[model samples]
Target chain A: MARVFMKGTEAIAEAAVRTGCRFFAGYPITPQNEIPEYFSRRLPEVGGVFVQGESEVASVSMVYGAASGGTRSMTSSSSPGISLKSEGISYCAAARIPMVYVNVSRGGPGVGSIQPAQMDYLQATKASGNGGFRMRVFAPASVQEAVDMTYKAFDVADQYRRPVLILIDGVVGTMMEPVELPPMKSDEEVAAMKEAKKAWTLTGHKLDYAHRAWIQPGNWSTKVMQSDSEEDAALYKSWQKEAEAEEFMLDDAEVVLTGYGISARIGKSAVKILRAEGIKAGLIRAKTVYPFPYEAYDHINYKKVKGILDIEMSIPALFVEDVQVAVKDRAPISTCLCSGGNIMTREAVLTAARKIMEAK
Target chain B: MELIYSRTKTIQEDKVSGFCPGCMHGTVMKLIGEVIDELGIIEKTACVLGIGCCGLQMDYMAYDNATAPHGRACAVATGLKRTNPDTLVFTYQGDGDLASIGLAETMSAANRGENITVIFINNGIYGMTGGQMAPTTLVGMKASTAPFGRNAKDHGYPMHMCEILNQLTAPAYLVRTSCNNPQNVMKTKNAIKKAFKNQLEGKGFSMVEIVTSCPTNWGLDPLKCLDYIEEKMLPEYPLGVIRDR
Candidate 1:
């Protein structure tokens, strides 16, 4: 594939159109608004439905209804807008509706700022809804990955019968990088995707004349209905194992650093700097945050590894908690956090790792 | 023996409704379903249900359906109809869902004359959320939230949604009928059929505000519920065609 330079938002929108997405509904918000604007002009040319909804709530529901009708649907929003769509996302999860959601996070506790920050780590990974239903989250670091993650999000959503989110921070969302998009599927492939909906859609119940009678259930019954089969339960159980991450320079190390999203990109530079100082340090970057990839910790020898540094750009040390939980009995963990728009640099992470190593 | 019943002609049987027993929602659903069947547009029809007892209409009917959030059926229907212009779109809402929380959405859609049908069911109380006072709850009517009755000094009088809707020139057909008695049931059916017919004729936004009963929430039996809707609610919200533009 010939790689071409593109922004993260553009890649996601283009990849969506490539991967059977025929309906795009969204409201304009910072970091993610570019996606809707890009699709608004391009989607119509391909005979796709693109609607700029009146509100985030309506935008998410538009995707919900369109997906319910057996069309591939998607929507995008930033922090505050994503907060507004939580109710709709919950409903889609409860109904096991297959849809894609792209969240280009910016600094926020409330109307915080539009600059790059990892403030939404907790919101994107946990308590996404009233129910503790887990939404599959993909944290892409670069523009190319953002586009590739969106194209793959639909496949994962369909395969699991659940909602998948592309959780990108403002740094990746706005930055332009090299990307090579695969050729869009032919008409036959698009038709096959629609035809494939029969395996799990509730479009209609085929009945005969002899079975025409109806028995009405109570209102409470609708709440208790079990739409997922035994096979679905088994597939859901294996999702955690299939999730992935990226590892660099972990084989011979005395200290390890863990991060994700834009922070991981910074972590790579820090790893090189620490290696130049003749310190044994490595980096473990997570690609899938929801699955948490617990097995990655087993590769590091806790006895030899003195400590771990978890760096993020959020208040209250959100991502570090995950790192602590993953390496519970193994080593001491420290956090590098920023509340507003201050992103941690390569020098900052390396300095934090050096402090941990010197303390040991 | 004519034996002329064919599965109510419109609704699918297995879905089995979730509305309370003796509730008027069932009658309203059947009427809408029959009208869809009569027009031969079931496949191309899409219904939007708001959050209320009446919104359970989606469970009873088999057309392309969507259950919208509280006060959002009209808004969602706007999107549904605009995207699939060939599909027949309608929004089903109750007094609370349509008149109170969703008032903005309902009025705006009506004002836009967005070619869609809205089956506004005025049951006087929020039945789904435990009988809270709705915007259309009659003054002096006691609900869970309005225990001392909806006071003119405090809560004000019940809103006449049909009259409010009639003020807009966009709606080509707007009628207020009841399902209180056999005679009124026939009138409600005719009103609904006409709403669908208006769409077939490309006549813009049509709505039929059906005066119905919520027996469980009203602290009345099925028969008394019917009597209350006919006597108390109807006198204040005079039953008639508010608009036939």
Candidate 2:
């Protein structure tokens, strides 16, 4: 496949379609509007359905419904919109419905800035909804990576019978880059995929009470709830092996910089500049934030590394908490942060690195 | 001996009704089961059940069903119906679920002319949550939340879901019926059947708003609740089709 220049959100939408996603329900939000817009135009071409729901709440609920019917379904929103969708997302998780959703994140605590920001790190990975359920959270730094992750997310979602989150910032969502699109799944393949879910999916049941399909988000019986939670705990624990991060030039480095999504992309540039200036700097960019690549931090040479600098566009620095858990006092950690949609600058990252170096 | 009537296979044979005495949900569920059986859609029918007393039917319903989040049954049905058009989809919702918390979803789905049926139970009070005031709770009707009776000054008048949905341009059918008496119960069943038939014909959005009673919540015996429906509920929500097309 030839690489073609495409915006991040558009490429993600096209990738989902090629991956056999036939149903999408979403409400419009900033920095991510191109996602639904692209799906609206492209889905019909492939016999897929696109619905702009009345609100984010309804949109996620719609995806839950569609996915329960054995369709590859998805929804997308930004920070506040994702907050509105948490309840439905939790329902999907509880019901063990396989679906995908994207969050083109922006600054937020309330209705925050519309520009690109990495303010939803904790929300996406830790507290997506009422239940303490975990989702495989993917943070893509470029359009090509976004395409690849979005394409593979459906398989992972189906395999785990859970929702997957593609977490990108406004920068990655709106930026344009050349991406190699995957081959579109044939209609037969799509139908077969749905057919594979017949055992669990709700396509209606004959008077076969023993094999009836019932999609309940909650169990009314205490015994069933307890057993389900125990099973879920084991499922979440098994994800430790799936934790992934891009460890760049960490060997013999003095300062290690870390972040995810656009902030990490900027941090990588700062690492290169610091290395050119004879400062042994490296980068650890998390690809999956959930099972937060703690093992990658363990591989760092604590004897040589002076400190770690956490780079993010969130002023309060939500991502640093995970970095702290990963590093675990092996090296002193510092942060370079901004908020309210202000993009993280490579200069700020370098300055922070230099300050960390000077402190020792 | 030839059998005149028996339980529909759509209802689980062994499961006993969980509904309170004088509550009309069991009767309505039986009517729906009969409709499903008569239409021969038992194998391809999927129901989205709302929260509140409506959700209790999940255990008794033998057909495929999804228990939607509170007030989200219509939205869920929209997704299910759109993605699997061959499958028959409907939402079973209560007054608080459809008219209050889920009003946006119900109205939006209806407005979009989604080819799905909605079975709205307007029982005037919230049954599952211990008789709280519902959007359809009649003015001057006492509730747990509105102890002084739903005064017009404080609490608004009862909402007529059929009339409200009839104002929309897309709904194919909107009817209000009740299950207070044998005659009215038969009428409610006919209306439900019509609503389901409309969905099968691809006629967009049909809703049968059944004006029912919650005897436990209404502080009345089952017999008196029937009288209340005839004397009070009917005057506010008249039985008959509000829209056919």
Candidate 3:
């Protein structure tokens, strides 16, 4: 397909539609309104359904319902709205319903700001809701990356029968960039995808108790709950192999910078500037934040690496905890922090990297 | 041997009733099953059950069913019915699940005129979590949360779901019936059948609120609970259809 200029939120919606998503339910929130707006217009044209739910709580629950019937369903919201959606998201995770949701993240901690920030890293990867359920959290840095991740997220969700998260900052959500859209799935292909789930989906049963579909998030018996927990633990452990990261010039660098989403985009530019200034700097960007790309840290040459710098648009840096776990104290770590909707700049990352290199 | 009366095939043959004795959930569930059997929608019908005692229906019904998070059954039904318009969808919710926590969802779905049926059981108090106060608990009704009786000054007044929903223009059918006696039981069944029939006819947002007895929660015997529904519950929640548009 030819490249078309599109906003991040609209592109993500279109990608979901192309991937055979036929149901969408969402509430309007800042930096993410384009998603539901685009769906409200585009879905009907493709014989799909779109509902602007009464609240975030209702929206995510609607997604959960649509997904239970084996339909490709989705919902999107910003930070505060995402908090309201946590209840339904937790239920979907518990019920093992396959759905996709996007967090066009703005500032947080109680309606903090409407501008872009990377403050939802911990919420996206760690405690998304009450239960300790893990999902494949995708952090896309640009419009094209967002489109591609949104396209593939549905298949991954169906393969595991779990929810997938697309975590992007407000800048990427509102920014326009040329993206090559994927081919739209044919109606027959969509039907075939749903047919693949007929074995377990809640389509309908002819009053046959053995084959009837039941979607329950909780087990009444303690024994059953314990067994389900054990199974989920093994499932989460299996995700370690799916961990992914982008290693940029990390073969032999003195200072290694790490981040995800837009922060890493800025950090990459900073690495180039630092290299031009006779500094051996490199960048490690996490594509899947849930797995945290721990193995990517091993590629850093600890003998030659003087320090590691964490760049993020969050105060009291949240993502650094994972970075610390990955690096395992091989070298000293520092942070370049921004918050309250402040966007990270290349100069700030450059300054932080330079200080880390000059420290020793 | 001649066949006289048999149970609806919608109820699983091996599953025993999990509802509390004297509780009317079983009666309502049976009526729902009978309606589905009569309509012959067993192959295409799906039930979205709310949390609490109403959620126990998942184990007994031999059809597609999903349990929504507490107070989200109406929203879930809206999603299911909208996406699969050909599928028969309904929500089974209790008073606390429908009138209290999920009032917003219920009202929104009803206001939007979503073509779905709602089977609401208004049993005055919360059953599964013990006799706690519910939004439909009558004035002077004693509950675990309202030990001093539900004072209108503090706990407000009991909510009439059918009356509240009738105020909305989108609802096609809104009725309140009970199973306190044999006649009322038949009336309740008829009301339920009408609600489901309305959905099948593409009429939007039909609801049948059943004013039922919760003997265990009411701290009364099964027989006395029936009298209680007649004297205490029926006065607050009158029977008959409020709207048939």
Candidate 4:
């Protein structure tokens, strides 16, 4: 597997196409624009369909429709555009239609800025839409991770018959890096992906009303709705076992720092600098945000640990809330946060860790 | 025993389209069923349902169908048709859903010349909700939202979908017909068959705009609603072929 240098957005698009995704529908937005642009040219070359939808609302609806037709489908956008797609994504969740989408996040509350930010942590992990539906959200720290996670997302989506989201930030979405791309799916395999899911997908098959796929129990039946909700709850609980986190330099540490996505990348570098200074610092980065990977906190050497610092690129520190819950107040937590297009800095994490250590 | 007529096997048994008693949605659904049977494409046809009164067709129609979010049937149909090129894909939408909220998707899909069929059901008001004003609501028509009547200046003008679509070069067929009477019903069915046939031939974008009535919302009996459609709706949305290429 020879590594090739590619932009994060382009690699993500190519990786998805290689993973049996043949239907691409998206609306252009900053930080994630290269994704749709690459698909526009690449998908047509592979006997696939690419639609630059009229709006984010229509783009996700197109994904829902394509997925319903049993095709491996996907969509991508930035924070603001994903906000518009929330409704259709929820429809996929309720229907248990397997599909993939990506949110290359930018600073936002309302189109706040187009620069790098992790402000969408809560939106992507918690309440995605009007319906209380949960999606498996993967946060990748580098361009290579972006490519790998995107390639793996489709399989997971189909396995669970649910939507999966690749949560990245502007830096990782646009930066170029050497990534070993996955093998492309041949035409036969693409068709087979659809054929395999035909038992439930709406592929012009004979009408099977009594056993058809639905979003919310068709024709308004309260009993069916309740049963469907219970089923979804069980599926959500099962994801706890799939949660993953990467632990770095944790043994014999006096202070630890935690982050994810691009924030985690910055925090890792900060830990190395602190260790060189003999500060005994370590890092724990969550790869799956929704399942949260609370077990990772148990690795902390509590007797030697002074306190943990939660750092990110968003103000009001949304990701920190989950960090607090995961740590369960075992250690006092301090926050180092920024927002509105400010990048999370390694210096900031190191400074915060020093403050926590000096306080002890 | 002698058989005069028989319903098509494509439609599910006793799956009466939960439409209002006088609504023409069921009759139109039956006509579509007949067309599917006539063309022998029932095994490869998919319907995309838009929200509104017409959205109910998803439940009763026997052929495979997916309900799109409100106002996005055309986009959904576009994706489905492109992904499964051999399959017959069509969208069933209402006035408010297609003309107002989904105007962008409808126009873009048609302009792109997507190989899909669209069945637009215009009944002047939003029938699913309490009689609210729609994009096709007639001038001086009183609606729950437009209590003082839809004045041209204040409420803008009623949207003529077929007329607007006719201007686009991509559509192989764009026609508006009625189902208020037996004679008009036959004409509407012919238009539907034409639209479907065009899709089978790989023609780009075909639409059959049927001007039906919402008696439940129109505050009239089913009989008078027919007359209202004939007298009021027809004049505003004159029934005829707007385009064919």
Query: What is each predicted model's overall lDDT from 0 to 1?
Result: 0.79, 0.93, 0.92, 0.89
DockQ for all models: 0.30, 0.90, 0.84, 0.62
- Cα-based lDDT at residue B111, candidate 1: 82
lDDT of 1 by residue, B62-104 (tens): 6656677678677667655655566677888888988887777
lDDT of 4 by residue, A238-341 (tens): 99999999999998878889999988889999998998999999999999998888989999998889998888899989988988888888889889998998
State the weakest 10-residue window (summed lDDT) of model 2 chain B: B152-161
iRMSD for every model: 5.9, 0.6, 0.9, 2.4
If both were scored by TM-score, which would come out higher, candidate 3 or candidate 4? Answer: 3
Give the Å error, residue A339, model 1. 1.6
Fnat per model, in the order given? Answer: 0.10, 0.86, 0.79, 0.65
Report clash pairs, candidate 3.
none
Give per-residue lDDT, candidate 3, residue B27: 88
The top-ranked prediction according to DockQ is 2
In order of appearance, the predictions have TM-scores of 0.89, 0.99, 0.99, 0.98
Query: CA RMSD for every model?
Result: 3.5, 0.8, 0.9, 1.4
Model 2 CA deviation exceeding 4 Å by range: none
Which portions of model 3 miss their true places by more than 4 Å?
Answer: none
Candidate 1 lDDT tens digits, A1-360: 788888889888999999988888899888777899999998887778887777787778777766655668899999989998887787777767789998888889898888888888888888776666787899998887888888899998887767899998888998898898967866678667766874333233232222321111112454444433343455556778966788888888788888899998898788888999999998888899987777787788777898888889887778887887888768888887776878777778878889988893
